[model samples]
Target: VLVCLILRLSGNVGAAPESALITSLPGFSGAFPSKHYSGYVTIDGKPSPKNLFYYFVSSERNPQLDPVVLWLNGGPGCSSFDGFVYEHGPFNFEVGNSTGTLPVLHLNPYSWSKVSSVIYLDSPAGVGFSYSENTSNYVNGDFQTASDTHTFLLKWFELFPEFVANPFYIAGESYAGIYVPTLASDVALGTKTGAKPIINFKGYMVGNGVSDPKFDGNALVPFAHGMALISDSMFEEAEAACNGNYHEPKDQKCSNILDEIDEALSGLNIYDILEPCFYGSAAKDDERKNTSSLPLSFKQLGATDKPFPVRKRIFGRAWPFHAPVRDGIVPSWPELVKRSGLSVPCMDNTLATIWLNNEAVRKAIHASPEAGEWTLCIDIAYTHDAGSMIKYHLNLTAQGYRALIF
Candidate 1:
């Protein structure tokens, strides 16, 4: 019945309120060479817009027609259904700590949906199950999340009008690297399609992106000594005391590189300083039997608490949370802003939740007047190594996009 209520709310859908739940998932039968669907996408007039859950894989026995990607995950309140059930998905979720039946994981031949048609969006407006009976329009930024993802891709290309001129792309990672280049430059500048062209945007991808918070603290002192998580003489004395300054005195070389990366990451264990390198391309006995039959660290991914005292009580009034509150002596920002009367301005809520003062992302797309042409890829070795892993390849070349950086 409605695909058993969308595979039982796609396995226990949390963060509730999809208009008091009713999924309706049926319709995936037969000569199956691809055809999947699950619903919800209702967002008209901002006030109480909810019901935005989606899944629509399609190939219907390929004839070379795919390319649709659109994913977004960054916790400007997280949930791109964990990039479709855990990175490059094709279905994955097997949690049942006290059960007798769990297995349901499928497809993984480098599953970027076997060549694209992904979508997975649970966005701006109280995240998962996407609500918003006006929780103050879910306090969004980045131009109301690129105008509610351009009205959810013009009602998902008016409910799949045979892929309305397919060739779309928009991937994500780390605050979706500022939500896929500000919603792929507002869906490649198309908003009033009365003259046709609502979207065919064929370019965008981001991984480990936080695109220029002034080069994100210029790659945290060489990615804290190439992920050994600090040392190499405290990343060469915080790269010679924040060398050519990074705006604002940044409180003395960010307080001596947060006191020598908190004395070399005290009690060293941010899941052994962020694991996941499952034997870079396998083989030491098949990467120790696939990191001992997976559950690859970061305290098996549940992240065994104490993430720097919960990011020092959630970014204790920034300035990079004053070196984890002066290495845990806590209380500083003008003595916790005169003992929590909370007079805001922690650099205007960290530059308006990282939209970094969005005047359409502070101009400069070569000063857009619909600045047609554009191309730029700043990789600096995955922006100074966090065990470097950035591989991009943009298309549409003849003078619009041609990015590439290994």
Candidate 2:
């Protein structure tokens, strides 16, 4: 029955080609069958283009007419491949001594591949295995990334024409917050086959996204208080001192309030501070010494024996299993701008501009040529609700796209 189900899910039941089950992780158990493909696409009619790496993970059951999800990790330079290995993919890195490759973790039952065939592409060149000999071609910004991704979709469809009609969704967090919407608008507005656009794009899902800078910054104070990182009084004082301006005069009193919050949350592990140094055995020992929940011999912190030191400490105390802050939510805006070709100082201003305009959302949609017909699906309650983030999602609706924030 399991074999039949797997065959039905993959659409490959006869003799069940062994090629599909080419690899499996020892400790990881799940139903995904992993495969990889590499090819080159001409970006500018060049004779030879850089090779692109793509990983396809299919669900265990016989293939259904599942949607295709293209996952892009922000960094403007970071690899979605890493997101695949660490977060939702069929494999995870096991701890090894010094420099050995650890066994792959099997697919997670909750893996998105189970519902949709997920494609993780290393994009824009210079990231992971995707590379270019022409250094000039490697530097890409938002426009270029969007253009390339659009082209990639068309070319990819040409290669696998069968999946061209499948429902497509673009999903990612953080910077992807920007990428998904921008690309969605572009694809929507673009025409394929000279008259119809090739991509069958549906909706997008973004989490903890950085959409509007002003809203995100302003939201910090309330979010801090809600998380108990700061007192309500402190928030009020900071608001008055800064005159509701959080970005100006980095040395202002409002800055101090945020600093205090940062300091208080520092050692508490509220945010994932990417430091060069790792917390060693001594730090782990100290933390465990006062804890009754863990055994004295517990070595969860430094249990890995990989070739290089495992810098990230995966916490086992909670349901989420990992530190929420470390999950790429907090992005270095300056770094993102530098990579995306937008001016660093202008980022905050750009977000601020979006916040000031009542018609900004409508304008942003019209700005894209591909979005011919669009509509607003803004969840006002979700946007204003303390727990939900509406500002982060407004851009999509502004582009005439439908979105449900809650």
Candidate 3:
């Protein structure tokens, strides 16, 4: 009954993918205020194409005039549903009464879609419901990811030509700090090159983004001291021992000091130190002490030997998950999986996992069952080939592209 009402309200919007139009969601019985669509946008078309999944919500206020914003998540392998389900998508989901039941959904008053249409995209093959038949597509890098996303934008516009004239913006956090600027630069370039189905490319915004290695790698030390997580004496000792460079140690003394800092931060949630870092009641003392979450790409913090149980929330302020790399390339999964002695994706995504994997939810969202089970994070052999994002930033900004780095 609700589905019929929603479909009636939406009427015959013919430009967008008709099959992808979602009339009603599983948990929300109320009629949708805005039209929602979810489907796959193929990149590098045909034969062995890379399909990137996207969930698009038209603006609740004004779909035609409002801006179209594309949102991505970091991890190089994390799904953009991280933002949709947890942060700013149109729904606020509550975990089911029991373990296996589906979560209930309520409208999010603060959803970005209230003012502007938002596209939550699962980019780079192998992340979320996005996939490719070619095995080699999964072994991708930053440059290829950006390029593929650009292709996605072009094709997505073709599908929703009504939004082609809407002002478009790219935004994301974490590893997407790398994703946003590179993709923005491509869109800006496309505008000049007479790319068909031209979008009104405007500006981009990144929150707590990882911009440069030198800056990102060196951020946590000062952050820790300012937050009182590290004692004044320890901060001073670290400052003197490492010569203010905690990201890389010059001597064993510096290495020992960084290890001590990791131990000090082991109990607190690195994403948000103010929050309690929960430990399972049965967790052993050594296991509790062994847990430490650090920045994603900046793993100079240290390593841990054991993994402990903790309920991690993705809404934490900082990007926490120490991903160790070698020769500047983020090593393939299972090789450099331990993040600062802690396991990767230290957050608890039980609700998202259950809800997204639900057959009814998948059917409503137009995600194919063949896309397989959905996990918050997947392992992709991601390479940081784009180098420092500074160049991309400079190029885009110089071309009159607006940028906001918060």
Number of the top-ranking candidate, with TM-score as the measure: 3
Best by lDDT: 3
Q: Across residues 1-406, which tens digit of lDDT does each residue of candidate 2 receive?
A: 3533554467541332233222433334454364433334445524336545455565444334678788876544555654565457655444422222233344455567767777777665555445555545555556667767777777665665445556677777654655666676667667433523356667777754545445555566566667665677877877777665654424556667656655444333322222212333433343333222322222334343421112232211110111122222223434433455422111111111121121432232122212122111100111111222343346446765555321
Model 3 TM: 0.83
Per-model C-alpha lDDT, please? 0.46, 0.47, 0.75
**lDDT per residue as tens, model 3, 220-311:** 78888898878999989988998877666788998888888876765455554554443345444433443444443234333333222223
Clashing pairs in 3: 303-341, 304-341
Q: Tens-digit lDDT track for model 1 on 1-406?
A: 3533443445422322233222221111123335555455677645566445555555433413577777887635555655554456554333222322222333545667677677777676555545545565555565567667867777766666455455677778765666676666566656334413345566777765555444455555565578766567866766577663432336665566665564454323222345322223212232133122222332355423322111111111222412211112223234444565432221111111222122332131111222121111100101111111221122123326433211
Off by over 4 Å in 3: 1-14, 45-47, 277-312, 315-346
What CA root-mean-square deviation does each model show from the true structure?
20.9, 14.8, 7.8
